[model samples]
Target: MLSLWDSWPLPLETAPPSSCSPPRSSCSARQRSCSCAHSVRPIVPPPATPRASPQYVHNSLGAHAVITNIDVTLRDGGYRNSFNFSPEYALAHARSSVASGFDWVEIGYRKGSSRPELTDGLTAHCDDEYIAAMAREVGPEHIGIMVHPGNLGEHDLDEAWSAGARLLRICFSPSDPRRSLECAQRAVEIGYVVCINVTRISTVAPKRLRRIINAVSGLGVTALYLADSNGSLLPDEVHALVESLISGHELAVGMHAHNHLGLALVNTIRAVDAGATWVDSAVLGMGKGAGNLVAEQWLAYLSQRRAGSDRFDLGSVLELSTRLGESVVEAAPRLDVTDMLLGYFDLSIEHSPRLAEIPDRHAQVRAAGLLAGADS
Candidate 1:
C-alpha cells in the first residue's frame, strides 16, 4: 500500500489562454483603416455574479447542541484492542453505528500494511479492498474513512471514492502548512469531502495557525479539523484556538480531542460554542494514547441541552457503546495527572523517559521539573 502513495500526483494546472485571433476587416475604396487594428482585442464574456455563501441549516436540535460524527473502525477502536479488530467486529460496529443515527461511521484506514489478526477474525488495519467490501456488506450510504496526507496517492483516492467512501478525515502535521494546503487541494480536485486535520496544534504558534487556516480555506476543502493529538489543551485553550481559526477562515471547522486530561467532552463542547460546526467522538473514547472525546458523554450533553430533538437518538448510541466495550477488552494506556500537567505545559512524552520508568509520587515531580528545565 505504501507503494501506491507514489501514484497520486498533485493537480496544479491552469487553463491556457485562447490562441485564435479575430479576422482583420479591410476598408473599401473610400475609407482609411483604423490605426488600432493590430491591438489585441479583449474577450468579452457575460459577467458572473457571485453566488451566496452556504448557510448551515441546523437540524431539529436546538442551537445549544448538535449531532456528532463517529469513527467506528480500528483507527479509533484500536485503543481498546491494540490496533487489532476482527472483520465481524468491524461489521457489528458499523451496523450499530448506522442504527444509532450517526451522521457517518468511518470504516477504516486505507493503508498498505496489515496485522495477522485481531479478536474474532478482524485485522488491525484495513485497506481499500477491505473497506469497499465492508461498505458493500454494511451498505455505503453512511461509511467514511480517514486518510493521512501523502499516505495514499491519487489512485487510492479514486479507489476510495469508488469503494463508497462518503467522507474523508485527512490528517496533516501542524508544522507543514504547504503540505496541508497541497493535500487539501488534491483531495478537493479528486472530488472528496475533505476534512483537513492540523495535528498537534497545541505546539503551533497562533500566527502560524492563522496562516495555515487561510491557506486551507483557499483550497475549497469541506472542513478544517483542530486536532489536539497530545491531549494537553485546556477547555479555554480549545475555545480560543477554535475562535482564532474560525475568525480567519471561511470553511466549516471541526474538533478532534484526545482525553489525556480527561477533558475531551468539555473541550469538544467549548469548541462547538466557539463556532465549530463539526464535533468528532468515539465510542468509549477508544482512540490513540489516552483516547478521544467520549461519544456517550457528548450525546448526553447534547440531549440535555436540546431535549425533544430529532438530531440524535442517545439511547441507541449508549446501547452500541455497551456492546462494543464488552467485546473489546484491551486496556488503554492510563492518563494520569502527570500526563495532564505535561500536556498543560506543552511537553511531549518523549521529553522524559525517566518519568515513565520511575514509579510513585516522585515521577510526577521529576517530570514537572524536567519539563521546566527544558523550557528554561
Candidate 2:
C-alpha cells in the first residue's frame, strides 16, 4: 500500500485524457479510466470496482445550489492572537454565531506532538480541557476544530471526539503530506463532519492537485476545502478550482480565501457562484496576515442571492462583528505591500522553521516587505 507520507511527485497518466477523465491532464483522470491503471505503475491499482458513475452525493438540503458559511474567527483568527482566545471571548462568539445563523463555528486548532514549539495560546494547544470547556459553552455540534495532518494520532482524535468536536477540518499541504486521507477516514468513522482542507491550493500544479483530490475524494468525507493559503488566487482561479472539484463528485465543495490581494470576498463569492457550497469567513476579516473573507460581508451578500435568506440574519451577524467581536478585529490586519508581495510571489505563510530560532524574525520579514514597498 502506498503511504500518504511517501515522497512527492505523484504518478501521472501516460495516455491521453478520455471521457473517464474529462480533464485529460489530471492525475485523477487515469483513475477514472482504469483500463491502464497498472500498465506503468509498480503500486496498487485504481479502485477495482468503478466509482458507480460519479454520482456526487452530498449533505446539503437542496436541489438548488446554496451557500453554507463556516465561521473561522476562532481558528484562523487565532493566528492573529498567537492561538490565544479568552474562554469568555470564544463562548460569546459561539453564542453570537448561533444567534446569527452561522452553519458552523470553528473554535481552534487541535495540535499534537507534531506542532512546532512556540508560545502557543490556549486554543492552539486545544487540550481536552479546552475543547471540553468550549463545548460546555457552545453546542458541540456547532463547533469544529482545524488540525494539521501530521500532528494528530488516534488518541488525539478520540480525545477530541470525547471533548465534543463533531467536525474535523484537516489542513494538508501537498508539499509535505501527512496521511491526510487517513485522518479524514478516521474522522468519518468517529461520526464527525470531515472536511479535507487542501491548503496552499494555488501553489500546487494541476497534476498534483488532481492527484491529491483524486486520492481523497473517494474517502466519503463531508466536504473538500480548497484553501488559498497565500491569499494569492484570483477570482477566476477560484471559480476554476471550485468547478473542477465539483465536476467529479456529489460532495460539497468549499473555499477558504485569504486577503493578501484584498480579494478574499471577491474570490469567495466567485467560488460560491461557481457551485462551491461551503465557505469559511472571519468576522470583519480578522485572520492571519491580511486576514480572510469577512463573515458579515459574505453572509450579507449571500442573503441577497435568494428569497427566504432570512435564515441568515444579517442584523445578528452585524452585531457580532461589531459588538461581540469588535475588539477581535481591532487588531485586524491591513492589506499592506508585504502582504501583496507575498500574494504576488504566491508564498505559503509557513516561513522557514529555521527562522523561528532567529530573534525578531517577523521584524526582518516586515523590513524586507517594506523595502519591497510592502508598506505602500
Candidate 3:
C-alpha cells in the first residue's frame, strides 16, 4: 500500500514550502513563477495579544500535564516532521510556549541511535549543548527531555541534568515496566522532575496493571502517566484508570491520550476531573499515526475554565499552528476508519503482525484482534 504521501501528495506538497522549495532569494528573474513561490503559504502575523501569568498555575507552573505540553509538541511532534525541526524553530516555539505561561516545554528526545542514519536534527538527537542553549534561552526551570528504557544509564542521566534540563520523562512499553521504572528511578536520583509514561495502558490486564502500579508505588518520581497509545479507551475507562492509579499507588497520576478515536481532548478532561494532575498533548495534534491531543485546544480549555483569555497567549499557539500547517510535512489529523478500529478493538495496529499482507488498516486491526482472541 502507498504511504500518505506516495498515495496522495498534492495538498501536502503545498504544506511544506520552505522544506521543499529552492531559495527564493537566489531565484532568477524568470523564476518568479517558480513552484516554491506558488506553493509557499504566507503566514499571518499574530496580532499583539496581551499575556497574563495564569492563576492556580503558582509562580512557576509545576510538574502538571495540564499546564505544560510545549514539550509534547516539540518532542512528540517530531514524529510527523521526521524529527527535522530547525534549532531556530525549537528556540522560537520554546520562547512562545514559556511566555504564554507554560510550566514545562519538552524539547526533544535523548535517545540512543539504533540506526544511526534515522536520528537527525536537534529535535531527534536533542544534543546536550543544543538543549542547554534552548534552556538558557527560555529558562531551564521547566525544560524536559524524554528518555526510553535502556537508552540511558546513570551516567547519561547526569549528563542530561548538567545540560540544563530540570525534568526527565521516561516512557516504555507496558510489557517491560520494570526497566522503564528503573530509568525513572535513576532520573529522579539524578535530581530531575521525572514522569514515567506507561505505553499501551488500555490493554494492560488487571493483574499486570497491579504489578506495575505496585512497582511504582514508591519510585519517587514526580508523576505516573497512563498513555492511551492506540487511543483505545472511553472517557469512563480513563476515569476508572485514574481512580485505580490513585487507589493502587502513591504516584500523582497523569493521562496521555491519542486522537485515534477522536477522544483525546475529552479523555484528558475526564482524567483531570477525576483527580489527575498531569496530561500530555502535541502541537497541532502532531505526533505518530493518529497523533496526540492538540496543545492549543488543551490550553484554550484551561484558560476558559479560569476566566483569562490571555492566560497563556493561546493565540500564539494558533499562530504557530498556522505557521506549522504551512511547513510541516504531515497532513492534519482526521478520523481514519482503521485508526478508529484500532481504538474500538483496543489494539495498536502499528505493532500488529502480518500488516504487510493486509491492504486496509481496518482489516489489519480486525485480523490482529481475531488472532489475539484466538491466542487468549
Candidate 4:
C-alpha cells in the first residue's frame, strides 16, 4: 500500500526556484534526467518500519541542545539605554551567556555607521574593529550579530564575516518579500549563516507569508525568523505559522517574540512544539516598544518540563536575568487588555494611543483606525 509519504511527487508549482537548478553537465544523460526531472518516475525502494519521533525532536539538533540563544545586548537590552551598552556590561553578558550554555550570544548590530546618540558608551553597536576585539574576547563559536537589511551594505557584511560573526540576522519588513530574499542571498554569498527576519509579521497575510518562505527557501539560507515586531502574535498563530514554514521549506525556522500581549513565553514554546529549532530571547524581555521573550522564563520552563535540560542552567540564567534587569532598569511595556485583544486579532496599537491616555469612546474609534490601517 502506497502511503502519502511514499514516493510522493515533488509539487512543481510550489517548489523553490533554486531547487529547480539543472543537473551538472558531467553527469550521464540517464542520471541527469533521473536527478533533475520531477516527472521522471523512479523505481521505489523497499520501505522500512516507522519509528517514533525522538524525545529531543522539539530541541535543536536533536542533541539535547537547547536553541535558546540570548540576544539581549543586541535587541532587548538595546532599548534599556538606546544601544548604550557599557563595555563592562557587554563583556559580563557575553561571559554569562556562554557560561550558561547558550549556543550563541548575539552581541549587537553591525549598522554601517554609528549614530552618536545610539552608540554612546555602547560596545555592542561599534564597527567591525570593535566587533573583532569582542569576538576575540568571547570566541567566534559564541558570538553573533544582527543587521537591518536596509542599513547594512555589501561591504558591511564582508567586514562582519571577517570579524568572526558566525551568525547574521537580516531583518526585513514583512510587506517587502523581494527585499528579504535578496538580502538572504547576498548574506549567503558573503559567507554568513543568514537568518531572514520578517519583521511586523502581524500585518502579513498567511498566503503571502507562504510565498515569502518558499522564496527564501530557494535561497538556501540558514534560517527563517518570524518576528512579532508589534508583540502581537498569539500562541496558536505562532504554532500554525511555524508548522507551515517547517512543512513547506527545508530551512530551519526560528521565532523572535515580544511580550506586549504577555504571550511571548507560550508562543516561544508553541514554536518549539511546531518544529522551530531556534528561539530568540532576551534577558528580562527588554526590547523595543514592549520587550521580548525573557531568557530566565525560558530556562525555568525547560527545567520544570525536563526539556532541553542538558543545554541550560536555570540557576545561572535566573541570576543573569536579575543582573540584566538591574543593569538596565528593565520595565515591562505598559499594555492594556484592549491592546492585547486587538493584537490577538492582528490589529496594531497605533490606533489607540489615547486609550491609555483618556480611556473613552473616542479612544475606541482610534483603535478601529489602527485595525483599518493594517487591512488597507
Candidate 5:
C-alpha cells in the first residue's frame, strides 16, 4: 500500500492570496486566500456540520466493534494532584480498569532526562521499580507510558520495557515532531508498540500538520494520535482532522482530548466517527487544566450503543471514580476562567498556572489574548 505522504510533497505550501481577507463563513475554501504570513490551507476540506447524534462503525456481525479505550487517569490525573497517587491507589485504579475492560492503562511518564533536580511524585517519574510493581499488579500487557522527546532519556525506553511497559506514546509539538519521530522509531525497533502524539492540534495549520502526520505514518508506529492539548477544537474540527489524517492510510488513529471547552466527549466521538480507533479518558475526568474525557461517562455512553459492551462494566468504572475521588484526587475537575481562556486561544496548559496567578479576571483574559497573538 502507498503511504499517505507518497501522494503529496513533504513540505507545506500555501496558495497565492487572491484577497487579503476572505469572507468569514467562506474562509474554509481552499483557494479563498488570506494575506497573513502564517496562513496555510487545510489539506482536507472542512467537514460539514456534525449531527447531534454520534455515528459509529459496526462490525461484520452488525454490532458496534468497539474502539480501544485507553485509561490515562494515573498519568494525566497526575497533573491535578502533583502525581501523588500512591502505589496502592495506582494498583487499585489499574485493577479496576482491567476489570472494566479498558485496553490499556497509561500508568505515568517515564523518568525524564531533564529536571533531575525537580522532585515530582511517583507517577511523574514512573521509575523502573514503580512500573515493575504496577506491571506485576495489573499484568504488563495493559501497561503503557508517555514520554516527551525532551524527557526520553537515553536508557528510558529500554528500561521501561524491562520493567514491563508494552506500549509507549511519544508526545511532541506538531510544529517540530522530528525528535519525537526519532524517539518513536527507536522504541519501535526495541520491540514496543509505539504511538506518536502530535500535541496542540488546533495550533498548527492543517497542511503543516498533514505533513507531520505523513512523516509519522512511515515510522512503523502502532498509531498516530491527535492530541487536543489545549482543548480548543470543536467536534466538526475533530471530524475533519481525523477524517483527513486517515483518508488513505492503513495506520490506526487515536485521539487524546482535553475537556477545557466541555467538548472532549463530542470531539472524541467525532474522531471515532471519522475513523479513529483509540480514545483516551480518565476515571473522573481528572487531569491538567479542565481535565480529560471522563472514562465513566464514555463507557456509559458506549454501553448504550455498542454491542458486547457488557465487557465494559460501567459500574466498575463509576466505583473506581468514587474510590479515587475519596483517596487519590484532591478535588474533582472543573472548568475555571483560566482553563477556558487556554481553550479559547489554543494556548497550552503550561500557561494555565500563570494565568491563574493574575488577580483580576479582565487582566487574565487580556493576557490570554496577548499570549495567543504572541504564539500565533
Candidate 6:
C-alpha cells in the first residue's frame, strides 16, 4: 500500500479548517451543504461571562423583580397616638421616606361617616387639604393613602386623585370581599394605583383566603397586601402564603407584618423569599398593639445584606426614626402581656378595648381565644 501520509489531499500544516467546524453564513449554499473542510469557518472564542452579584439571588425569591419598600410610619404610627400625628410630623416623615429611597409613604387614612368616634386628627381623617399638602410636600408619586372598604365611597377616588394621591390602599376583611373589589375596580378606572389589603389574614380559613387572593389578583389592583393584623403569623406561614399567592399570578404581593411575637422581620424576610415584592414598615415599630416591623431595623438589615447597593439610605431612615421618639413621648413600641395574648389567640387589636375590660390577664387571654373562635 502507498504510504498513509501520501493519501492526504493537502499537507497537514496547510490543511483547511476541520470538518467539525461550522460553516459561516458567507459560505455559498453548495459549500455549506458539502462536507469539505475548506467550507468550515475558523473558530472564535466566546465573550467572558459577567460575574453576577452574590447578593442578587438572596435579594428576592430567585426572581429579578425589584422589591418596593413602603414607609407606613405616619399611617400606622398614628394608632399609637390615637391618630394624633401632627401635620408637621406627618410631612417630615414623608420627606424622610422619600430621601431614604422608600417607594411609597402612606400618610394616613381617609375618614368616613362610619367611624366618627375614632378621632378628629388630620391624620385620622386625611382630609383633602392635608393630603393635597402632603402630595405637594413629598411629591404625589410617592404618596399613598389607605381607606377601609366601608369607608371608600363612589366619588372618593375622584377626590383622592384630584388631591394628588397617587396610590389608594383599600383594607378589607376576608369575610366579605365584595365591597373591596368594587372599590378597587373604581380606583382602577380613576387611574389610582390601588392596593387591596386582606386584613386579619390569619383568621380566615385556608380555602377562603385562597379564594379572596384569587379574586383580588384577578382585579386590576396594583398590589395585594396581606395584613398580619393580629401579628399571629410565623415565618413558615408567611413563606407558604406568599409562595402560594405568587404561584400563578402576575400581581405584586406585599406584606404588612405586625410584631406581636417579635417575628415581623423574619416573617417579612420569608415573604420576600417567597416572591413578595412590597414590604410595609413603621418607624420605631410604632403602631397599634405590638406595632409593625421597625423601619430602621428593616433598612439596616437590607443595607447589610445587599452590600454595595445604594437602594436604601439606612442613615437617613435612622435619623427620621429617632425624631419620632423625640417628638412623641409615648411613641415606643410595647409588647405587653395583653399584646402577646392577642397574638397567641389570633385576636385582632381592634378587640383590645373589649379585652381590656376583662381586668385579669389570664382571663383576657382566654376571652381572646374564645373571641377568635367565635369570629372564625
Q: Which predicted model would earn the best TM-score?
A: 5
Residue 57 lDDT (model 1): 33
Error of 4 at 75 (Å): 2.1
User: What digit string (tens of lDDT, one per residue) describes model 3 on residues 1-376?
Assistant: 1121122212211111122233333412111111011111222223433334544432112332333343487777776667887777778878777765667788888863333357666777777776677767766676888877666544667666666778887775444455676677676776788887777776555555555566666768778788887776677667666765565556777778888778999988877767677778777888766788888888888778743446677777777777667766673755666666566555565543354468876567557567534422
Cα lDDT listed for each candidate: 0.60, 0.67, 0.65, 0.61, 0.73, 0.72
Please report, as a residue range, the 10-residue window in candidate 4 with the lowest summed lDDT.
29-38
lDDT of 4 by residue, 181-217 (tens): 6667777877777788766676555555665666666
Off by over 4 Å in 1: 1-68, 112-125, 174-177, 331-338, 349-354, 368-376
Residue-level error in angstroms, candidate 4, position 317 = 1.4
* Residue-wise C-alpha lDDT for candidate 1, range 1-376, written one tens digit per residue: 1222242232322112112212222422111010111122222222322222222333222344333465543566564465566677777777677665566777766552222233222333355556666666556556677765545554666666665666777776443445546666766776667887777666555545555565566667777888887676777767766665565456878888888778888888778877777777888787766678887777677656644345556778788788776777753335666566555544554454545556666556655655544543
Residue 269 alpha-carbon offset, candidate 1, angstroms: 1.3
> In model 4, what are the clashing residue pairs, if there are any?
76-286
How well does each candidate superpose onto the true structure, as a TM-score? 0.73, 0.76, 0.75, 0.73, 0.81, 0.80
- Of the pair 1 and 6, which is ahead by lDDT? 6
CA RMSD (A), model 6: 24.0
**What global local distance difference test value does model 4 have?**
0.61
Q: In model 2, which residue pairs have backbone atoms overlapping below 3 Å?
A: 56-249, 56-250, 57-250, 337-374, 338-374
How does candidate 6 score on lDDT?
0.72
Deviating ranges (above 4 Å) for candidate 4: 1-68, 112-124, 174-179, 330-376
Q: What would the TM-score be for candidate 3 when compared with the true structure?
A: 0.75
Sort order, lDDT high to low: 5, 6, 2, 3, 4, 1
Where is model 2 more than 4 Å wrong at Cα? 1-63, 112-115, 175-178, 324-326, 350-376
Any residue pairs clashing in model 3, and if so which?
65-278, 65-279, 71-106
